[model samples]
Target: MIVYEVFRQERKGQAFAHAGSVGAPDAAFAEAYAREQYGRRGESVALWVVPREAVAEIHEFVDELQKNYHRVDGYPLKEKLKEARERAGTAPPADR
Candidate 1:
């Protein structure tokens, strides 16, 4: 395989994300190198290493077409907040 996958966790109960990639001959060497390359400073709480051939990769995620309706910006609140503040007679404290 042309690439090796490496993942690292920030701390206990945290998620693991892609840290980097390296080249190696076997799983033993790849795991050793990946640990050193990504967790040398004792920064990672855990790791996962896999060969490129054994791992599946996809770059064409559909984040572009899929709207994030659960995101903070997805909730329209500017007009509602302005009206609420006006109703409460608390007009957004003067800008500094």
Candidate 2:
């Protein structure tokens, strides 16, 4: 029996999540198993059943440029807010 990885979508326009795995004899059986196990109770609106062998595991990621814009620490929010408040004449006393 071949093992299949199942991804399920709960509703339309939503991202599919990893539901689970199932052991089946073939692609058709894998799909049928996925539907019966995941979608039969209305738990999932859609299911994707892919053979385990077809899935690839990614281990390393390359970030040579060291981009940080996506991280919270990348933006100096506190400093900017303070500067904005000072410019607007609403900043509290520095001693406070």
Candidate 3:
């Protein structure tokens, strides 16, 4: 028997979430079992059944060096805004 991972969409336009698993001898059986187990009551609008062995497992993600430049806070917009305000004569440059 093959273990199939099931994902179900609760309604139209909704995202599919992991429903559960099913053990079946083939793809056709897996689909039937997954549909019955996850969508029998019409609670799920769609279903996807993938063999568990086909799924890739990722346990960890590592960043060798910390990088802040990609984040919005990495840009010092406040300093630039202050400079622009002074140039526009909207406000006096701070005495700092």
Candidate 4:
């Protein structure tokens, strides 16, 4: 038996999401199984059945530069806020 991946679209003009998988001997049976499993209740407007071997899996991502500016901790917001408050004479007493 060959494994087939099923994608389902719940509404017209919408993107298809990964529904599940079905194992069958051929494409026709795989499609039928997918229809019975995913579309029997009319939950999916459309179905796409593709052999699992045709799909590619991506596991590795490269980020060699170590860029951090987009993260919140990358900016010294607390220090900058303190400096701004001091300059504006709105800083609270250090005892607090």
**TM-scores for every candidate against the unseen true structure:** 0.57, 0.74, 0.71, 0.68
lDDT of each residue in 29-69, candidate 2, tens digit only? 99888989999999988888988899999999887877878
* Model 4 stretches with alpha carbons more than 4 Å out: 12-15, 70-73, 91-96
**Span of ten consecutive residues with least summed lDDT in model 3:** 61-70
lDDT of 1 by residue, 1-96 (tens): 457888899899999998989898878888888888998899998998877678877887676855768578777889899989999998867675
Ranking by lDDT: 4, 2, 3, 1
Q: Which prediction has more favorable TM-score, 3 or 4? A: 3
1-96 per-residue lDDT for model 3 (tens digits): 999999999989999899889999999999999888998899998998999999899998665565668778779899998888988999764575
Task: Report clashes for each candidate as comma-separated counts.
Answer: 0, 0, 0, 0
Q: Which ten residues in a row have the lowest lDDT in candidate 2?
A: 63-72
Candidate 1 colliding pairs? none
How accurate locally is residue 30 in candidate 1, as Cα lDDT from 0 to 100? Answer: 86
User: lDDT for model 1, on a 0 to 1 scale?
Assistant: 0.84
Specify the highest-lDDT model's number.
Answer: 4
Q: Model 4, range 1-96, lDDT digits (tens) per residue?
A: 999999999999999999999999999999899999999998999999999999999998775776668667678789999999999999999997
Task: Report the error of model 2 at residue 37, Å.
Answer: 1.3
